[model samples]
Target: MDSQHPPSPDSEQQTTSRKRRGIGRIGWAVLGTVFFGSLLLIGILPRLSQRSELQAAVKEASTIPSVDVITPRRAAATTNLELPGSVVPLNQTTIYARSTGYLRRWYADIGDRVRAGQLLAEIDSPDTDQQVLQAKAELAQAQANILQSRASLAKSVSDLKQARANLLIARQSWERWQVLVKQGAVPQQDADTKYATYQANLASVEAAQNTVNSDSANVKAAQASAYASQANFQRNTVLQSYKKVTAPFSGIITARNVNTGVLITAGSGNSNTSSSTSNTSLYTIAAYDTLDVNVNVPQSSSGILETGQTAQITVRELPQRVFRGKVVRTSNAIDPNTRTLLTQLEIQNSDGVLRPGMYASVKFAINRTNAPFVIPDSALVVNAGGTQVATITKDQTVHYQKVAVGRDYGTEVEITSGLTGNESLIATPTVDETEGLRVQPIAQTK
Candidate 1:
């Protein structure tokens, strides 16, 4: 019975007391509410203040000034126009073989100076030699025939004289017989016999005359044949002389195509001969002391060019030197396809410095006093209105000006109809700026 009432030991009595305690719970809830409310108020108030300051700063940045730029104008010296061309020999000749023969020996070669009629090479013409021998033999035979005909003609003439004497004697005998027949001292038969003898002698004289005529005709034929053979012999001799190739003019041999033992053919469409060595020319001579430069100038530049005008030439091989020359000739007509004028300049190359086939640059100093105002090409601005430039006014304002331009010199341009040359020009203008724009300029540094 004592334990069933409630065994309230010391630990059990303390637990019951704690379960009955609830007063501090309301105080803790009130403290948490006050802490959270203070945090909300502190965070929101500073953000609202910062937002207004940021707006004020943005407004201030909007009033900042723009950057300024400046440039200067300069006067440039007049320049000449430079063009490109090639060098060529003023007088060039190609040497060709006139007769074909085996090359025996070459006396001249490339770079060898030769005089007119100088021996260039020698040809072994065995065929031509044989022709000469044959012609000589024919001529001798013809002369022998002529001698035989003359002998025959002399014999015929002697026979004709004997026949004439016999005819005269027979005629005298016939007349004596006729007188004797009239005087009865001769028989008729005798007279008839004498008359027959005279007739026979006359016939013999006619036969001798015909023989002489035949001999004379034969002599004439032999003489003609001899003349023909002589002509052939002379032609062969002349052709044999051609075997030694001679220089046509005084010049330097620029080429040689023949060597020893090479076969050369006659020039009349016969290819039976072959050269002993490949790439051998008979001779090629040229006078390199004088040279010509051919230049193709644009049609627009053709009008100002004239014969006898001085030209300055620069060869690529001789870079450090310039050659002085004069215009020798011009085509006088423009080429339709290239739209250019073909001009030639003659240069004296006596020092052998300027060679043919060298590339060259020619400078033409054209007087362009009639040309318009010129400016730096950098000042031009290309847009929808053709070409324009930015000009600075006296009041420090910029103007976008339209201009008509001409020949361009890479870094400069010619103003054909647009500028007065007195105004200041800007080399480059900003895209955001336009006509009548106000600016504060700072001088440009070089």
Candidate 2:
């Protein structure tokens, strides 16, 4: 119908209107395409930039292993260390007879509590008593002999005086005979006889003097013999006193192997003769007023303990008890075979609750003069060489440090000789970690 109407003026005007409408439609299509294209570009440009950056970062990260790191915590001034231990009596001894004889009577038996001087048993030491009596009699006899020798000395002195008097009288008689012979009033024979009598009296005086000297020496010998006899008597008396067996210290008797009428030998070279546990002892006494908790502490932790440091003891038998103890002794040396120290803790046991050879746990609160850094237990690397840890420096270089470890608490460990607490430590070092490997350390948040 439009093609037939083209001869009219409306038809020309409609054709021109159609051309304008088509041009308007073409212009709107071009504007819509330009706007949509600009929106698409605006949305995709940032995404593309971000994807490029992400890919670049992945490539960089793949060259280095990412690791979580932790800063070591400063160790406390005092650290608690627990070690397995055994409880023992403070003083233990095996009793043996001091005198050789049969056991006469036992005043204290096994499980008996006795004082230091309490009688434990009696020995029928008849020979010791007989020896004491004999010594005493010999001493008395020696004293009597000394007295007799003194009397003989006195008699010899009297004889010497009598002989001296007789010599003086004979001298005077001889002098008178000589005068008579010179005066021709006496015979020569009488003068000669008086001279001979004087000479004989002089010889008797010399004999009496020698007898006095001999008697004096005899008295001295008797006195010395008496003194020796007295010493023997005293020594035998001391030996006799040993017949009464007594306790050497205050304690409870743990064992008694001898009874009345048992033949107990004295000073027999057996286990009882020494300080060790005696299998052939008459009795065994253990002092339980204090107990010793012996623990083998690691050499690293041993140096921190001292003699007066207080410790805690937990007994397995008494699970609820926490016994207060003091560090009494230590070997002060590291055992080469075990690499440990023998430490002993002393605990008061006045209540008699603790016994010897009981299982125990000893806790020593040792104060370190130089406290070590504490790190997570997972950071340690143990190998055939020794224990080590991985640390990262400020330059992001991995450093494998040889560390001395102490007091492992499962979650944490003490670095006794390595890091300065400020080092960034790797949680777990890999086998490929070296001293100068560059690493990407990620700080552990927790």
lDDT tens digits by residue: candidate 1, 1-446: 45556556987988877766654676788899999999989998898889888888666645532323334333334457678888887766655555566677879877887888898777787888999999999999999999999999999999999999999999999999999999999899999999999999999999999999999999999999999999999999888888877887776887666556666655421122352433334566776788889999887678888899888999777889989889999999999999999999898888878766788999977776556677767778898877988877887778877888766778877776667767666766667557786655454555
Candidate that scores best on TM-score: 2
For every candidate in turn, the CA RMSD to the true structure comes to 23.7, 6.7
* TM-score per model over all chains: 0.55, 0.75
- Show the lowest summed lDDT stretch of 10 residues, model 2: 269-278
Compared to the true structure, candidate 1 yields what TM-score?
0.55
- Rate residue 216 of model 1 by lDDT: 96
Number of backbone collisions per candidate: 11, 0
Per-residue error at 292 for model 1, in Å? 1.0
Per-candidate local distance difference test: 0.78, 0.86
Clashing pairs in 2: none
Lowest lDDT sum, 10 consecutive residues, model 1, at 268-277
